[model samples]
Target: MTDFLHLLHHELLLSLVIVCMLILKLADRGRSGSSWSNLLNVLLLINFAGGLLIEAEGSLFDGMFRSNALLHFEKNVLSLGLLLVGLLATPYLRNHKHSAEFHILIASTLLGMFFMLSAGHMLLFYVGLELATIPLAALAAFNLNRGESSEAGAKLILSSAFSSAFLLLGISFVYGTCGSLQFEQIALTVSGNPLQLLAFTLVFTGFAFKLSIVPFHFWTADVYQGAPIPVAAYLSVISKAAVTLVFISVLYSVFGALQATWTPYLLITALLTIITGNLFAMRQDNIKRFLAFSSIAQVGFILTGILGANVDSEGIVLYFLLIYLFSNLAAFGVAGLISAATGKESILDYRGLHASNPRLAWTLTIALFSLAGVPPTAGFFGKLFLLTSGASLGNYLFIGIAALNMVVSMYYYLRIVKAMFMETTAQPIGKIPTGVAPAIALALCIAGILVSGLSGSFYEHIHLLTLSY
Candidate 1:
């Protein structure tokens, strides 16, 4: 029992939060939305704090579940993301009728991600993957009155179903060839044979679907467009971060031997993803769809880091993700505020925004700058390291292509900034009041973006965490 408690403290703490949320639902009658939102915020902060303090390093359930310093750090990263999402969402969720249910789904999906981060076996990973995915479909359709929301949900369901099938087939292949489902055992037995290579391909395809890689990203824009802004932010930051952590781990550990086989494929897909995302984003008028494509392009950069196959790769990726969380959420926070206040979701709707909402315009401008990987922001540092890491692979041409895509990304990202700061509009959006919770969230994101890059402390700390790798 002591071993269980020590090894699984993070999971146990989150489970408690989920239960408490369930009980709260029963007694939620007659409660003000502010009170409910406040309570939820408190719980999320507690979980985030607990993740930082908890310490565990071991395998459990016959290696079905595991934990270590690195995994713990990754979990904390995710916890921080959830907390940020909760804080940013408070403004929109407060007074909404289904706010409680929305939070419950969010918490449930978070629990699933926790399981995913700790899984040591294929079956455990699969279960966690499903847990992490299913609730998001409901979240995508959260706007009950919006037909587009329902369409988003149906599309997500179909996409997730197909991905799961591909993943399961991959797992089955591994089991048949390696005669084991445990990652360590698979690593020991995998020989890069044709069958095993095929298995890895299938699994990679599944992850591709989840990560919104090119050719598998058809659902992303629609889903982001239809989902509530907060939910879209969660899907963009938290969901992508979780899968990215797992993808790096699986590729580095269980399939490390097959690196030679998969690197070429990753290279091709990464290029396609960057180009496709950039071109699509340039054509998008909807802010949600624009960010959705931007996120896809970011994935291509993440792949570049992963291709490094060096010690620094994991830390660089994690650091990039940290920067991305702040940068992307900052943009989304501003968008959410505008959408909630004026129902404007178009790039053109932002024309002359600085005239009335200079603060929001500036905040979004800084965010887009970061996303464009411009200097003087954390995103600049993040992309720099990712490119440097990929250069370790000695593929200058590919790295150059990736670098050029960053320039392409800049044009679209700056287009929004131009609209907000320069373009004139007859009917610009009026000044929108950001409530206390959202204001605080935006402040935090801005601080994180500005400070995290200049300090080097965050990157150093991440390096320390990944030392065990």
Candidate 2:
């Protein structure tokens, strides 16, 4: 029992937090939103801290589950991201009627992601994926007051249903071909046979839906525009990070034999996703939608990195995600503050924002700079490593294309910055109050952006952890 507890301490603790939060809700049914937000934030901090303290390395449940330094590191990075989300969203949540429920849903989805990361069996992974996805549809429609939110919810549900069907069908095909669901067994048995190839394609389609890869990304912008800012932030950062973690693991391990088969396909999709995302983002007026397409472009770079198949590829991807967590969330944090206070979501509304809201203007500027992969920001290093890793495959042409798309991304990202600092509007957004929680969140994100790139130790730590995986 003690061994089980030690090995699964992160999961156990998170589950306990969920249950305790539920019991508290039952015990005090009328608690205010601010009160609930405070409690949730404190519990999330504890959960993250507990994850750090309880590290174990082993397989359990007959290898249906596993753990190691690398998986632990992934979970910790996710926990930290969620912690930041919870903190950044506090300003919006404090007055929301269902603040406790919102955090609960986010936490539940995070638990699902945990299982997805640790699953040793295909069925376990599928189960975890479903758990992670279902709650998000509800979250997308969380703003019951808005019809667009309901539409976002419907679109997400339909998309998730189709993707899940494809995933299950693919898993079935793998089972039929290999006669086992265990990742290790399948990894050992998988071949580049026609059936296995078809199966991998189906599975890749499912991941494409989750990652918001080009064609499968139609629902993203609408969902982001409709959902509450916090939910949008969670979906953009936490959800994408989780899927990317599992996607890389499955591709690099279970489908290793099919590398020759998938590389060209991945290259094509990466190029298209980056180009398509950048082109679409330039035309978006809504901030959420713009970021949505921007995230799609970011995933393109991630797909490029996965082509490396080198030992350090996983660590590089993880490091990029860490940088993304800070950079993307900072952008959303500022947007949320502005939206909540001014009820403005248009890029044009931000014109001359610096004249009145200089702090937010600068925060968003730094975030945009990071997202555009501008130098001196962690994002620059993140993209450099990813592109470099992809270059290891000797596909310099593809890598070069991906690198050029970065310049395209910069134009759109800077459009927002230009509106904020350079352009002027007669009725520019006035000074908005930054609450304690959001202030801390934005400050942490800024610090992360500035300090992480300059410090080599963070990447070194991640690289060391990935050595075992």
- Candidate 1 per-residue lDDT, tens place, 198-250, comes to 99999999999999999899999988998999999999999999999999989
Give the distance in Å from residue 16's predicted Cα in candidate 2 to where it truly belongs: 0.5
**What's the lDDT for residue 31 in model 2?**
84
Candidates' TM-scores? 0.98, 0.99
Model 1, residue pairs in steric clash: none
| Poorest lDDT segment (10 consecutive residues) of candidate 1 | 28-37
* Candidate RMSDs in order: 1.0, 0.9
Instruction: Provide the clash count, candidate 2.
Output: 0
* Model 1: lDDT to the true structure: 0.91
C-alpha lDDT of all candidate models, in order:
0.91, 0.91
- Backbone clashes per model, in order? 0, 0
Superposed model 1: Cα runs more than 4 Å off: none
